[model samples]
Target: MLPLKGLSVFDFSTLLPGPLASLILAEAGADVVKIERPSSGDEMRTYHPRVGENSANFVMLNRGKRSLCADLKQPEVVERVRALLERADVLIEQFRPGVMDRLGLGFEAIHAINPRLVYCSISGWGQTGPKASVAGHDLNYLAETGILGLSAGADGAPVLPPVLAADIAGGAFPAVMNIMFALRERDRTGKGTRLDISMADNLFTFHYWSIGSGTSGGGWPKPGAELVTGGSPRYHVYKTADSRYLAAAPVEERFWQRFCQIIGLPQELRDPEVDKKAAIAEVQRRIAERTAAYWCDVFAGQDVCCSIVTTLEEAMDDPHVIARGLFDHRVKSGSVALPALPVPVAPVFRSVAEVRAAPGLGDSNQELLGTI
Candidate 1:
């Protein structure tokens, strides 16, 4: 048993953000029951290219959790959820602004049934913003909040992040932290608190460094021109001789100097007379002169903060990751690879007694209704 083994959570959310939040709780040993729709269920279940019945996205994000599919529109279903909430210590939801309210499962409504429930609402723009009612994805939220604008490519279109910055960082992480703190606070006051984790708000906060840099007179990412935003030679991805990529970030002066020395670049490489483009071009040229593997070998045990760009396949088989057993395979609905939770303690068991593989449209009717 882990720290949260007995703490029950009612997770009424789906897709990337809310499910991930609840999954974290589940991983830590909370008895989290994911409340999916009676119809369609969680969209992420079939979002990706499926290997048999499971989607890699769903299985990875959702391990060690039970699914309680409910037609939340039904009065009996809503009351059933209320019953769970009455006993649960936490409730997490990620519906757009008014969906919960329409379902008569708003925080105010449910909190009346169980004032001790730590309620958390995860949304794109939060529950009360001007854009609160508007629909948005991770990219749109970050774009509106200025994070997507910064550190974007020098090309025309902005690049979407590989990971869900807003989802994991903004939604899941904060929900876990806040729920934990609230649970702790309830130890003293014996009452729970509500949380509004807006994806847009979190994105804005994620851009704090750039925001501070600009508004505070440090200068923001001037489009491929800022610290870690491609202005400095120390930070950026370069195309190597074999057409593979190498990412280098020697941020500090010493590290930058060391990187230059390793690559045989002169101090004159920083001269403005050569122009930023020409200087970067020279660096690119030098990097391209050698294969990525060659540079990878050269930068070993160096303070250069340099790394060969590992494709997803390469990352899974990386020596360091393999040494730590990070991506050990497990048979879920089928054989699957999952990243182990990066924590101090090790896991005893990796499976859960879960039924209804990601809920195939109203799969939990009998279970949920029987509970009622």
Candidate 2:
């Protein structure tokens, strides 16, 4: 049986963070029911680049889950939801701090109904901080937490992240991990607990090395100037003749020696005591003399830890990725079917089904609310 086969989750979250947490639970066999608003439902359903019926974003993040639409302002609807919470194993929400309390569905209220429910609240800040009620997004959270200031572009400005690290890494992954911890605690104490997951607060963990460096009197890291950031010649990106980028990270002494040999660098330039700027410039010049494909062929059999940066499409179709079965599971809507979003859950814990459909808005309202 799946690990969470009998667990029940009521997810009152929209967009990226909370929904994604619940999605991981559902992937591990929890019966997750999304509680959305009445007509418009979650804003993600209307996002750009539509697929079968809803936005592809919604379909990918919410596959294999049921949806129940209810107007929380209605007393009858609130009562029905409370009845369902009495038997739920997990509850996830992402509204501003007091919004759930105003709706009478907060952690304390739900804990009273079912003491074993793992109640999780995800927000940009946190539940009781000075900025708890303030509005923010992924970029704002990264900027506020000093993560965005560390990576600077050639223009000397902090480069915007390509993905939602705060939402997925900070908010969603931490919520899921803590919910599992809370569940284990409930098994020991026979009582559940509240989880306050702050996206901005959790971002500090990603910079542990930088934090230790500053605290240990080794000087704080400057923008684009750390060993793993763009400061070292052994761990930096170089441009090839066709303008494609090669991500090179032969940091170890052995790999660095091999990389120098493969690139045919001069003996003097191979020494670390030589001017780093000169070494980096020479490497860039040599790489620029050849195309990315030429470098790919040259480094194919070697283990110098380098790769030509591939596009998203190319990565998706890579033979090694396909062999690993990352995209084997499919999400379906009407006749349109695409690979499901691969969560970090291992294959042995996920469902055996190959295909599952994302629910339409309010698809479970009658089936779930009528009984409740």
- Which candidate ranks first by TM-score, i.e. highest? 2
Q: Give residue 219's lDDT in candidate 1 (0 to 100).
A: 63
Provide the lowest-lDDT 10-residue window in model 2. Answer: 223-232
lDDT of 1 by residue, 1-372 (tens): 577888889888888778777776776678778787654667787777774466767766666667777778788768777776777899999988888889988888888888888999998888896888998887787777777766467574567778778877877777778888999999899888889988777766766677787798876566577756787676778999899989998877778778888888767885544466666887898999999989999999997899998888888788888896655534254444444333222455333333213333444456655765
Error of 2 at 155 (Å): 0.8
Question: So what's the TM-score on candidate 1?
Answer: 0.89
Find the candidate with the highest lDDT and give its number.
2
- The CA lDDT at 191 in model 1 is 89
How much lDDT does each candidate structure score? 0.75, 0.93
For candidate 2, what is the lDDT? Answer: 0.93
